[model samples]
Target: MALAGWICLAGHLCWMTLQCRSVSGKVLEETYTKWLKYKDDCLRQIQQDPQPAVGLYCNRSFDLYACWPDALPGTTVNISCPSYLPWVQTVQHGVARRRCGVDGQWVQYSEGELWRDISECEEDQETHTEELWMKQVMLSFRVLYTVGYILSLLSLLAALIILLSIRKLHCMRNHIHANLFLSLILRAVAVLLKDSLLDQHWSKPINTHADVQHILSHRAAIGCRTAQALMQYFVLANHYWFFGEAIYLHSILITSVFLDNSKCLPYFLLGWGTPLMFVIPWVVMKLLRENKECWAINENMYYWWIIRVPILFVSLVNFLIFMKILKVILSKLRADNKQRYPDYKLRLAKATLTLIPLFGVHEMVFIFATDEQTSGIVRLIKVFVAVFLNSFQGFLVAVLYCYSNKEVKAELQKCLRGWWRWMQTCWEDQ
Candidate 1:
């Protein structure tokens, strides 16, 4: 019996270590280590002490999940829920019960495995219903975003091909658009891959032994971490490319003629190279400080800010430049009458619409909103708007700048005429 107890304790310690390392990073890991150490000392003291009146009571021991004190025969022993459980925080004062048989041995399942009843730790019916509803809501959100990304992917790909195929459209402005399209494509792919990886590995029936083992194995897996890092890099790159677009537009309209060079090297560096600066450090910090679980959930705000701050900086800069651009456009419209530039107002409207999504100025609507800060309908609206904008921005940009551009339309018409002439010549030859 003593050997069995020792083995159970050892397994419990390993399980606790794995659970801690799977979530919330180093802080929870340290806390669980201290807790397991304390429990070990208590168990050791119990071993050193004399037996409790020989066979009149159940021996104090650790089960594979929790510790229990000695109890009189034919009685039940209850303890506070184990802190190592993922859901324990939701039921801080919950209890777990273990029954002692009349023979003074801890009860076991009919199949001969030890059982500890933790039903009290489970959520009540109301909470379970709420959880079900939340799951449904989240599933809807996932579907919506997945569809949006798919559509965006197709649109962005078409736009990129069109921009590349038309030689007349090859300029610094078009080069910036191509880079932006590429970044969005990569971002969409990364997000889909990351979500799929998580769903395949981490999404499972909670509290099952198989589920726990599955999570433990994948938590530190290189594939999961690599997916996470790529997601971060591409997300950052997408935002920086938005900045690149804004900067290029601002340079042409506002900056001196000398600054408006045809070379796209600067925009290329900004769009692709700049994300490495933040992503490498963010990866290092996560690996060193909070390395756990596909690097998706960070309890350390500082490490998260490494990725977030740069994106925020990009957004803010783009917004300011957008305002300046708007001011210039409005001033130009005011200076020129309807007779001077008859379609000036129409062109101004199109430019304004195009730049809004390109600059990501729409993000400011939910920039300050967070899961902690908002609840109820406000959070619902924020989430819906965020998902809609984020998923469809690529599509919107493709439509505004590529499919709807007069220059691209002219190029497409020319290509079609040449193709028609070639087809006619081939038909005559036949």
Candidate 2:
């Protein structure tokens, strides 16, 4: 039954496909649809050669019967820009100014020149320079994000192995860490795959934004959509596990009413199961929405925010619980008898540093304001800060909870000694 359930879940996830309806998409559809109809007519005529002609030769003097390039009567040919340049627009993103006259033939460049497209998209020096600078800065951020996450993954794996290997390290607290670490690993993988999907699309040069859209429409668009959903899922799972971290502390220090490990039950349920409520609605809405995007990144941004509310609530509740736990610890600490609980205060402090940065609740600072409105140096700075903070989350957690923990440090030292003694014995035997 468990295996059957897993198969059903996989089938459901694999069935979704994305469709987009951007303004650029509409222009592309019209441009190609016109040409395709003309090609079909030319092929059927079979006058001499069967292939459709690019354009017909016409005299400079207007001739009443002069044959022109195949086009609708009284309609100008609309040429869309290449996908790499920008978009098919009059002002921004790259636009073209080639038109076929009433003769159904393409207009010439001049008396003796071939037609040349009037370039406007990033045509100005300032706009082109700004775009180049933005691309370079984004490239740097991608490098930092990828390298940092990979390093964090390696560190988290090493910490988990050490925690599980030592009998002394196996505790409820470490269990929470294990779950959070796993969530981090999964989220990082999903984000990497999402970026990889975009790389595959834009890697090769395509003639128009329409071509890029068409390629994505027919290709593995579902893969990109699935990556996005999984990223959302695992990111939330990581935050909820942080909530579990706070809950664990709350149980240990404030609420002594629960039996040993009973608190873990609620943590497990919330960490794994609560996301289903958010993800289900987002998925169903995406599948049913009229938009073309395989994912829910639409103009109104409703689909994206559906999951955001839950994350905000979780982070807020966790923060409150964490503060209460800290208050309880301070209240329990007697001033004159402070030496009695020296290690207790240290544990509280470590937990504070560990949970806050690990889950990135402190990132609430920039959550409301992305760099969409800003430009120039301000946008670059915002991008840098966001990337730097998010990239180092797993690193901070692993360093604080595993590397800095006294028990883990002592266990690691013992492990090195064992390995050293084994090496020495092997040398003697040789």
Model number with the top TM-score: 1
Instruction: Evaluate residue 11 in candidate 1 and report its C-alpha lDDT on the 0 to 100 scale.
Output: 44
lDDT of 2 by residue, 310-358 (tens): 8878778776776777676556654524656657667667656765775
Q: Any runs in candidate 2 off by more than 4 Å, and if so which?
A: 1-113, 117-122, 205-213, 256-260, 263-265, 290-296, 330-352, 370-382, 426-430
TM-score per candidate: 0.81, 0.70
Range of the 10 consecutive residues with the lowest summed lDDT in candidate 1: 16-25
lDDT of each: 0.76, 0.61
Predicted structure 1: lDDT: 0.76
Q: Best lDDT goes to which candidate?
A: 1
Count of backbone clashes, every candidate in sequence: 0, 12
